[model samples]
Target: MKNISKIFMFLLIIAIPQIAFAESSKIGVVDLQKVLNESAKGKEAVKLLEVEFEKKKKELDIKENDIKKLEEEISKRGSLWSEKVKQEKEEDYDKKVKDYRRLQTDLKDEFQRKNKNFTDKILSDIIELVRTVGDEEKFSLIMEKQNAIFTSSTIDITDKVIKLYNGKEKGEK
Candidate 1:
């Protein structure tokens, strides 16, 4: 009976700390996607990116149309032209096509680079904010929504974080 009591005491001692830790643990969840999509700065950043890319997109469209027209002309008029003229036209068409493709690739690469930079900057700001929130609120663990298997709405701090982020952006501007 004395040995049983000692074993019981040891188990109780181990379990008590775990129970206390579970009770004290404060977890928070943030949906970064939600914050990025819903925040004012995020929305504005998207609009800016779109506007910045729109001009290049229009230019690409025009270039594509020009290429198509040239292709049509080559097909329709090549038979009527002398060999030299036909060959020259075909060469010009090929060169233009190559130029168009290169420009398209350059534009795509630039857009992706800009987008990643913007996303990184914004997400960096958000993570800083999350850290601040976690510290201030005494959260034991704060996790990204995507990383979690499931989270209760009560533990979700996304809206709160978004509000804070928007306010910070407003203050900055």
Candidate 2:
């Protein structure tokens, strides 16, 4: 057992230099969310998305108000209303609720689709930019800043990536 321990220590000593060398590799970190928030194209995309969101919000609000009014009427006058009338009102309310729920789901899906499109395009461009930067700057590895804990500013290439990505976005526009 002692001989095995000695051999293990010997192997560990031999591996130290390789571990040190690996740590010395040219690694970079990029803050992709920062790039998306600060870049011109990203700003434009957000603004457009917000417009769509607001437009849908207005429609939902109007429908919601109508539903509220109907509910109030049913509640206040339902006792005096004929049985058939009360039943019709209840059915109408139910249908409106169903429509509202369906519309909400549809809007959510539409927003997600738009968001995915923007993200997919932006991420694809960022990947290409990262590749170019990696090749030009001779980076051995690049990781997202979101996953990092204590990366030195010297290895933070987020600004460069954003600049390169924005340049490409400008050219494409």
| Best by the TM-score measure | 1
Give the worst 10-residue stretch by lDDT in candidate 2. 161-170
> Which residue pairs in model 2 clash with each other?
none
lDDT of 1 by residue, 1-173 (tens): 99999999999999999999999999999999999999998898899999999999999999999999989998998899999999999998999899999999999999899888988999999999999999999999999999999899999999999999999998999
Best by lDDT: 1
10 residues in a row with least lDDT, candidate 1? 111-120
Candidate 2 structure quality by residue, lDDT tens digits, 1-173: 99999999999999999899797779999998998888887888999999979989899989999999999999999999999999999999999999999999999999999998998898887888888899898888999998988899999998888887778877888
Report backbone clashes per prediction: 0, 0
| lDDT, model 2 | 0.90
Alpha-carbon deviation at 2 in model 2, angstroms:
19
Give RMSD to native, each candidate.
Answer: 1.4, 3.7
Q: What is the lDDT for 129 in model 1?
A: 99
TM-score of each: 0.94, 0.84
